[model samples]
Target: MKRSTCDICHFSIKTCVCSYVVSPKLNNKTRIIVLQHPSEVSVTKNTVRLLTLQLTSVEVYVGEKPSDFTVAQQIAKTHHCGLLYPDQNAIAVESMVSNSQTIDTLFVLDGTWKKANKIAMLNPWLNHLKKITFSALPENKYAIRKAEQSYSLSTLEACAYFLECYEKLSAEPLHHLLTGMIHEQTKFMPEDVKKRYFHEDD
Candidate 1:
């Protein structure tokens, strides 16, 4: 049977994280545009929903094709757009900020590396934007989920960090919310299984 889910956070009611949802949305000038793969929309561990809920300037489009992103494309054309993808010529976020390069809109791909690569390949126009990347990433805090890369961060964490550095805001609220959600999720896990997947120190 399908579990009843919360209309807000979208988690199963028993595991709903609405309590951790930020009350006043975090304000920022850089508009976040998340190009989410359709497969990620229903995944329990995906963080894009939380990101959208807490940030005032966020747009999420769920699809893998160019046609699905026409609005995003238009926005990109009109704004000082930058893609949060680490390409060979990508500029570090700090460097861009230091140099006073304005990024009115940031495009973030929400998917695994393979899936993100596919999105990049399908949308050739994305390559035309200035690529932005992080130089030093903090430790991953989403302990309930596993990432293929050591440097990988959940969508929420990435956005939070980007906004922290770019907008000079604290990411603590989002980080705290994520920690609470992880704690809530671990409550239902079998002791042995939970031990294998998560550690207190992490």
Candidate 2:
């Protein structure tokens, strides 16, 4: 039998987190686009799915390359778009924070580190855009996901941090919502799942 999906959050009934989905007012000119891998769409723990539900203006596209996502490619071409990838050539988000240039759009990769790398490598158009990356951040509270580094943050966390520091917006609301999500998801995750991905050492 097919699982029932929540109309609001578009998550399976057993996994729907509509309760924690708050309507955040993201009235800004900068557009946030999430380029997700198709494989991530069905993952119960995917944060980008939950994130798009809360933030009204955010857009999500599924594909490994920009050519496969027409709108994302068009936006990259037409708008002053930037890629939120930490390639060696990427400029620190901190430096862009004070720059006079206005970024009308931002493209973020939504997948695991390896998966995200694959997306970046496949999308050659992305290399031409302004490569943007963040400084080291605090430990993530995404209890179900492990970080390769102490500064590794979940997709939503990175979006929130970027908005707070670069857009002069408050990340408190997003943080509050995500904290509740982690708490709920953690309660249901199997011990083995927790051990492998949420290892304290990671």
Candidate 3:
């Protein structure tokens, strides 16, 4: 028999994260398109799910290639595509942090660094987009999973910063939601990990 799922979060009812959802509506020119690898979708700690639950107008495409995706092709053709990848050619988003110069669409890759690299390499069309990056970002909140790099951030954190940079907006609701979610997900980790994130010394 199949278990019931939460209608909103789409999680198993037992694991429904409705309480931690930070549903804040955004009205901005930028339409965020997330290209997600299949592997990241089932991970409970993944932040893309939280982002979708919290924000509106976020288009998510699941696959490794642009042709395999439904919305990615049309999005690239119609709008100014800005990829939030930290490549050698990527421009720092801080320099373009003005509401005057707007981005029509922003594409974000959701997966490990290796998976994202593989997707971009295979999808040659992605190379044509304007690559953007952020600097001086705060440390990632995910203590449950270790990152390969010191500057690595969860998908939700990246999106939050993106909003702040492009639209002069703040994601306070998202911040609180993520804090609660991180605490709950890292319950099995050592006390130091949780303390490092939540303690006054932090």
Candidate 4:
């Protein structure tokens, strides 16, 4: 397999995007943690890791075993933990807080529906987390994943949207830019799936 370089920064994975991607400016002391599936680490097109790129407070960790919980556990020590999952019966993301207090540990699982389910199930600690169900009014603008709507967003997209929604700010442009990155990655997909993913709702 060949590697793709960032057109703007010209950085490769081991040295470039991973080392110097800029993070998003944040307020109110919110922290984001992306528990990426180990399989996603090598996919040059995966956008999940980009959360840490735009958000200085965000961290990314990948693995199969929950025993690799040191980093997450450390963060959970100080911040109340909330897992981002879509289940209508689940509590709203906003309700995770009380009395104007901000949550410190927010776990956003990044993967396909099947992979995410396996990861969540494999990690018992994740299941114990306070689940957050997001019902955002905004539609998902991520062109890469090409879902029916914004109702279901990728990991990075969800993080960006959550920040925008809770902070009352516009993150749409940034989300579109992330979609551009996805466009670069399309070459790696099978031709038919690539066409389907890109032209789904058009």
Candidate 5:
């Protein structure tokens, strides 16, 4: 039987996160563009959906190749855009913030490390954009999902961090919502599993 899903958040009725989703009041003009992997569309753990719901200037495009992102490319060409990927030559986001350099749009790739790298490789045009990365990341709070790197953050977390630095605003609300979602998802897990991932004994 198909589970009844929330038309908004798309999570199953029992796991709907609509209540925790709030549109954060951003004071900056930076727009967000997410290039999501097709395989992640239906995954409950994916955080791009939360971003679309919370940010007014966010767009999400689903694809893996250059052909699939023509519209996004056009938009990027017309704006001071940057790709948020941690590459050797990527500039730290803090450097841009400190220098008062602002981008009109920011492109974020949504997928696992390998899958995101695949998307970047398939879309060679991404190489032409200014690449930005965080110099230091906060501890990962996404306990329900396992990432290849210990410092990996959920898409929502990374975006919040970027916005915090770029806009110089508090990301507490976004972090709060993320914590709620993680709590909701982990509530159904076995105690041992929760302990292993979240280090919660109770």
Candidate 6:
């Protein structure tokens, strides 16, 4: 598959989309490394790639565990390294704070449930890392895809919501830019898929 920084929504290079690119400057001490499923990288509407484009601190490792301990070691250097997932057994992101004033790292797995699980399990080193769960207020408004009703969320959705809860961050302008992009991409979805996912039942 061909790779272009181009977004399906704006048909513009990823960095050019200022709205999607301008993530709130994370705490300098906090590094976010995203382990994305290779397949997710190719999907036109996926948001992990967008986040990758926007943040310089974020490291995107394309495939399975690296041959050496380099990547895990780098992430471990941070004061904290927590996995981003909603598993009940996982500790809440908020609860992980030993000191709210200090910066820490958050490692997020970006893919479908099964895909994320495989990524986590395949790298045993990652299993020992701290885990951080989150609580969100249900801002599932993006038009590009449907959210799993009970707890599942798209990578973008999870990141945006996490930022909101922890940073008390709100970026209406950025959200507008992202939603507009989503609308642009989903505009061409087949009628059947649109009908199936366009509207969530009340």
- Choose the strongest candidate by lDDT: 1
Candidate 6 lDDT tens digits, 1-202: 6445544333445423444444454332356678887877666667765555544456776665555346665667655667786556776655444346433677788777788887877787776666668753465665556554556766766766665555555635346556756766656678788766565562
Query: TM-scores, in order shown?
Result: 0.95, 0.86, 0.86, 0.73, 0.92, 0.73
- Measured on C-alpha atoms, candidate 1 has an lDDT of 0.86
Which sections of candidate 3 miss by over 4 Å?
A: 1-4, 187-202
Off by over 4 Å in 2: 148-150, 189-202
| Position 69, candidate 3: lDDT | 74
Candidate 6 clashing pairs? none
lDDT of 2 by residue, 31-63 (tens): 889999888888877788766766767999998
Off by over 4 Å in 6: 1-29, 66-69, 94-103, 146-149, 171-174, 189-193, 200-202
- Model 4 earns a TM-score of 0.73
Q: What is the C-alpha local distance difference test score of each model?
A: 0.86, 0.78, 0.78, 0.64, 0.84, 0.62
Where model 5 places Cα greater than 4 Å from the true spot, the runs are: 23-28, 98-101
Q: Model 5, 1-202: lDDT tens per residue?
A: 9989889877778877888865554444688899999998988888887777667778899999888999999998898889999889988887676335567789999999889999999998999898999998877878778998877899999999998887776777678777777777778988887788865443
Pairs that collide, model 3: none
Q: Which portions of model 1 miss their true places by more than 4 Å?
A: 98-101
lDDT score of residue 181 within candidate 5: 76
Q: How do the residues 1-202 of candidate 4 rate in per-residue lDDT, one tens digit apiece?
A: 7676655444354334432343444442467788888887776556765554555577787875777667786676667777888665667665444335545567887777777787788887776676777755455556665453336676776777666655554555456556556655564679888776666555
CA lDDT for candidate 3: 0.78
Alpha-carbon error at 182 in model 4, in Å? 3.5
Candidate 5: lDDT over CA atoms?
A: 0.84
Candidate 6 deviation (Cα RMSD):
4.3
In terms of lDDT, model 2 sits at: 0.78
Candidate 1, residues 42-89, lDDT tens digits: the string is 888888878877888899998899999999999989989999998888
